[model samples]
Every structure is written in C-alpha cells, then in structure tokens.
Target: MHFDLPDLRLFIHIAESPSLTQGARKAFLSPAAASARIKALESQLGSRLLYRDSRGVELTPAGQRLLQHARLIMRQVDYLKSEFTEYGTDAAGHIRIFANTTAVTEFLPEVLAGFLAERPGVTVDLQERLSRDIVRGVLDGAADLGIIAGPVQAPGLQVLHFSTDRLVLAVPLGHALAQRQSVSFNDTLAYQHIGLHEGSTLLSFLREQVEKLGGNLALRIQVSSFEAICRMIEGGVGIGIIPESAARRHSRTMQLAILQLDEAWAVRERSMLVRELDALPGSVRALIDRLKQGV
Candidate 1:
C-alpha cells in the first residue's frame, strides 16, 4: 500500500510500543495526531491495522505483515538520507558508535584518533554500554557500529574479528598471587574476588567458565564499571579478572599486579562483534577496513 514515510514511522513506533499514548510520546506527536496518522494509513491501505482493548493496542494480521516491510523501508530511507548527505566529502557525516566500557576507555582512543585524522569532517559519537546493549543498538539502527567482546550470537548481522584479548587476573601488589607467572581458575576462587555486575558479559563469561570447570566463583563485591572494579582491587578489596588491556593500564597508575591465567582457564578472544557489514556508510566502512588491516 502507498504510505508516506511519516505515517509509516508512526505505525512502526505504535507497533513497537503497543500503546497509542506511549507511541505518540515517542514520536513527539499528540495522541490525537498519532491516531489520526494511523487512521489515515489504515484508510489508504483499506484495512484495519490495529485493535484496541484494555490491554492496549494489538496489531491486526495486516499490521504485522506491514510492520516488517515498514521497518525495511524506514531503514532504506535513513540510509539514503545518510548516503546523499555524506557524498563527495572525506567521510563527512555523523557516525554513532556503541562500545563496551573497556573498549571506550582503553581500546578505541587510537582507532578514533586515526579515524578522525583521516576523515576530519566526520563527527563520531561514541557511547559506552554493555555488550548486549551494544549489539541491540546496532541492530535497532540507534548506532552505526559497535565494537565489543566476541562470540555474540545475533541474527541478521555480520561479525568480524580484529584483535584478541585475554582476561587477566589483577590483584594488589602485595597479594600472594602477585608474583605468580600464571594462575588457574581454581587459584582465583581461593581469594575474595571483585567482579563486574551481574549482567555484564565478562562476569557471565567468567561464571560459565568456572562452572564448566566444576567450581563457583566467590565474589566479594560486584561493581558496575571496570574502572571501579580496578579501583577496588587496587584498594585491596579483592583480586579481579579483567581484560588484559584494562589491567595493564590500571597497573601503571596503581600498585596493582596482573598475572596471566592458566591457558585452560584463560578466556581469550579476538575483540569482535556483529554489524550490518554491507550497509555501513562510507565513513564507517573506512574505519572497518582499517580495523581489518590491523591499522
């Protein structure tokens, strides 16, 4: 059915929120205005698109089918706008990127610096989020790209590996394990451990690895940020296992020590994740190409 872009966007927003009022708020339109748009769309398509009840609005069969096509059309429209605006310039446009805290703090500076040097007009907006949230942002079109820890399983996205990082054990300089060249997972369980908060990918990965080894991690404190975890470990709250790059940086600033985990217990992977590989804008594509070349 022929539909204007604004009405389709309103419909998709309604489909996602399922509350006319909530959708209107998100779309920054009055409820009446939003409802009118939906009605106009329904009339043009000659079908009832929504059913309202005490439980809020539910999409009809036609609405469900149209929702899929609507999303695709909206994405293409956005891409087309970005493409036209970005043409004939040195990657001049906005690039919204979502990366995990560790990447934001430790890994992305060099890459971002280099990217900006090459494409001075391109504005880069980067935010730190959890790995899962990073993936969601990219898939939902809220972010142009994301860099996070690997092995994320999500459909309709392409994953690429650019670098490998290992989880290292960090402790106070005076901790008994500080001098050890390497320690095992069981060795870590002996001490009180500082860890990332529950929903974190690092925490979940460590938990799974420990569980697979028929053991459980004994956490003394669960902090929300890597920087906080490092600060706590440095203050002697407890030892922590964090990405090697993060640990190394903290080591330079504080009296912290790091030891590589035993090979079997070490969780290491090329820092990788999924994104729309083919749909990336020129600026994003340039950055991805550099990453692929290990630049």
Candidate 2:
C-alpha cells in the first residue's frame, strides 16, 4: 500500500522490455539494484511478479495486472501535472478580446464570466468592434483574440467557428409584420428601421443587404444596443432586424414578435480569430481552449 513510484515504474519497464538488465539500464539503474528492487517489491506485494531465465524476464499474471493499474496511475499523474502547472505562475496576464456587437450582446458575456471565474489570475480586456476591425486588431497585434461574424477575409489568420446567429425582424405584437411568419429583406425596407449606430456591424450589414437587393433601408433612428432596438419596436417606434439571440431575450421582457427573414444572407456565422496558434503563451492557449468550450 505504501510502495514508491520507482517500484511501479520499474515493474512496467521490466514488463515492457522482458529483460531485467535492459529495463534497469533504461530506468537508469544498475542490474544489481534493479534485481534487489524487484525482490523487495514482490516481497511487499506477497506475490511473485516475474519469471527470470536465460531468455530474459517475463511477467507473471500479477505483474500484468499491476502493469494495467500502473498505466492508469501514470496517466492520472500526467494529467495532474499538466492541469496544475498553469496555477504555478504568479504573474497576472491580460487577454485582449475583441468582438462584434452581436457576439458581445448575445453570447460572450456568459462565456467570459465563466472563463474569468475559473481563471482569477487573468484579466480580460473585452472591446466591442466590427468584425473587420476585430481582424485588424489581431493582425496589428492590438488584440490577443477575436470573435467576429464571417464572410471574413483574413488571409493569414487562424479561425474557428464559435457560434451561428441570424438577423431577424422584431416588431410590436399588433404591428403590420407581426401576423406574418417571414418577410424578404427588401420587402421590409419600406418600413422604417430602428437600428444600432451607423458604424455597427448589424447596421453595415443591413446597408450592404439593401445595396445588393436594390432596396431602400429606411433607417429612421439609431440606438446603441439590441435591447434598445427591441424596446423601440415594443413602443411602436419602428420594426428592426436584430440577432435572433438578442431578440429572444428582449421578447421575454417586452411585447415583441420575432419574424424570420426570407433572405439567404440572414444567417451569420461567428468565428474566433487568432494570428497564429503556437505564437500564444500557454496561459493564453488555455484561455482559447476555454473559449472554444464556451466555458
């Protein structure tokens, strides 16, 4: 019950090599020392663990069973070393995280909260920027990580799919578009839109959609957040297109209707972007893993 790791490791080494002399050499012990150690281990276990002959050493049944458990124990020890190694660093680190409005509003707050909770030693500098700007921030080394909507053009950037979201039109309960289930992006253009600020990703995307469809995106007002846009819709100010996740949250608190859009470009894929994988520090790599897990 109190046997040392060296005994278990030597048992595995001898079992693998089938030669006490060769296994002892591999374990950095003399043959005489290896033989004495095995005898002591066998005496402690109350069972013979090896068959030694001119051919070399072979494991008895007990040695095979010990080998199985020893492998499991070694794996757990390795995991403990890997998992606990990061906690040894006392220096505080900051990760510059840049994300678009949709991800910042709809998804990442919860993810970041959990990541920060588990990693108290690290600080996150979260910034809201457009997807293009997020890419620029990473490329310019201004940000360590980026979460942005795709159809992105970052030739040298490493990216992974983070989440999928769609832009939907939200309207008041008795509004003209409420009775219908879906509407084309162009068809909704006639109605005034309550949107985010002019430079927001959603606003820029809407403007792009309007130009591609040859329609007028009649924007009558602009707000800072999706909740504000939904509140404007609830007050009968005007209907607006917002992320489905943000729309769902506001719908619970306000009398708003979610209308799915009839356009193919409505679904937006969000991705995590980095300059290079190996360039990141171990702690930063762990942060990326946590983000990938949505932790």
Candidate 3:
C-alpha cells in the first residue's frame, strides 16, 4: 500500500499510545483526521489495523506487523534528516532505547551520560520497561535497542553482556532476618514486606516466585523509590527486596541490613539486546559500543 510518511507516523503513534485521542494529540492531528487517516491506510492495505475497545486500542495482527516496519522506517527517515540537515553540524541522529528498571536505576545513567557527552550531536529517547517487555519491544522493532536483566529469553535478537546486579532483601538492623547471611525468597515471605508498587517488574517477579512456592508476601507498604523502601525497612516497618547496587550504598548510612538470597536468580546478568547490529545509524551504534565497554 502507498501511504505517506504522515499516515505511517500516525499509525505508529496510535499503535504505541494508550488511546487514539492521545496518539492523535502526540501526532499533532485532530481525532477526526487521525481516524480518517487510519481508515485510509487500512483500505489501502485491505486489512484492519487496530481494534478499539473501552480499555484502549490494541494492534490487530496486521497492525502489529505494520507497526514493526513503521518504527524502522521512521528511524531511517530520522537518520536521513539528521545526516542531510546537519552535514557539518555536531548533533546528527536519535537513539531510541528501552531498558528495564534495574538497568535504568543502577547502571544506565553513568553509561548514557558518558555517551551523550562524547556524542553531542545525538539525542536519546529512553523508556523504562520490564526485562521481558524490553526484549519484546526490541524484537518488534519498537525500540532501536534494549537493556534487560534477569534470566529472560530473547530468541531471535542479538544479546550482549551489559552488567550484573544482585537482588537482596533489606531488613531492619534488629529484625529477625538481619543477622542471616543468606536467605531464600520463600524463607522471607512470611514476614511483612515493603515493596515497590504493584506494576513494577521486580514486584511481579517476586510475587510469581512466591506463588509458585505456595507462599505469599504480606506487603505492608508500597513506595515509589528504592530510597523510600529502604527508609521504611530501617524503621522496622517491614523487609524489602531491592537491587544490591542501591541497597549497599544506603546500608552504610542507614540502620538497615542487606541479606543475600540463596536462590541462583538473585545474581542476575543484564544484557543489551538489538534486532540487527548493522542496521543502526552511526551515532546510535557508537552509543551501543560505549555501553558495551566493560563487557
């Protein structure tokens, strides 16, 4: 089907946004115009693209396929614009990166800062997601690259070693589990917990692990940041599971204890994933290479 760049841009925005109106707003189109453009695109392709419902919009199988290519096409267009317009200028391209919370919170900041400083002509669009979702987004071409942690499987994508961070239980200094050197997740579930909010990947992973073992946590408090959770743990509120990178730094300043988990999953190796290494623009590729420095 012959659709213009605006049509494809609108389609990609609609597919990624929570609602059509929101997508239209992002695309700088009115709702009516967006709807008409979508209809025109679908008619050209001879298939439905999106399924609309009360909750929001979901991509039809065809829509999903279109979205995958749309992202790649947009990236190419962006690259072309950057290269042509800024031939002699410093900044040139955009890099879209999707990373898990662990990577974002613990490691990516320093690495990304270094890359951005070295490559001033490049801009970055970074979003946080769960490890599995990061892998899915990369494979689907929704993002140029992804950094994920935990034992996630990405069948067809290229995965490179990124970094490692241990997950541990943070307990009050005088709490029962505090003095223990290493404890299993199951062994700690019976105690009250201070966890990240429900939608966090870490929280979901912990709950799934507990349920599989026929145990559950009594989450007494939920907080938005690791610092808040650590504070609650130090106040004898409840135990919390947090990345060792964050917990260790806070441990020296707070009356909190870090207990390692006996489970193998506790020590996780993070990976940086890409759909195709060679297809990336030069600036984006440079950033990726810099991120792989220590690996």
Q: Write the residue-wise lDDT of candidate 1 on 62-130 in tens digits.
A: 998888678667766765666777353336767777876567766678888988887766888888777
Once fitted onto the true fold, the runs of candidate 2 whose alpha carbons sit more than 4 angstroms away are 1-91
Query: How many clashes does the backbone of model 3 have?
Result: 2
Ranking by lDDT: 3, 2, 1
Report how far off residue 56 is in candidate 2 (Å).
81
The 10-residue segment with the lowest total lDDT in model 3: 83-92
Candidate maximizing TM-score: 3
Candidate 2 lDDT by residue in tens digits, 1-295: 6878887787778877958999998899999999999999989999998999999998899887777677546534443444455564322356778888887776778877766787777677888887788887677555768888858898879988856878888999998889999998877988999989867877887888788877788877999999889889999999999989888988889999999999778888878898787756455677677667752
Candidate 3's TM-score: 0.89
Model 2 RMSD vs true structure: 19.7
- Each prediction's TM-score against the native? 0.77, 0.67, 0.89
Model 3 lDDT, residue 93, Cα: 76
Off by over 4 Å in 3: 18-21, 51-58, 80-91
Worst 10 residues of 2 by lDDT: 74-83
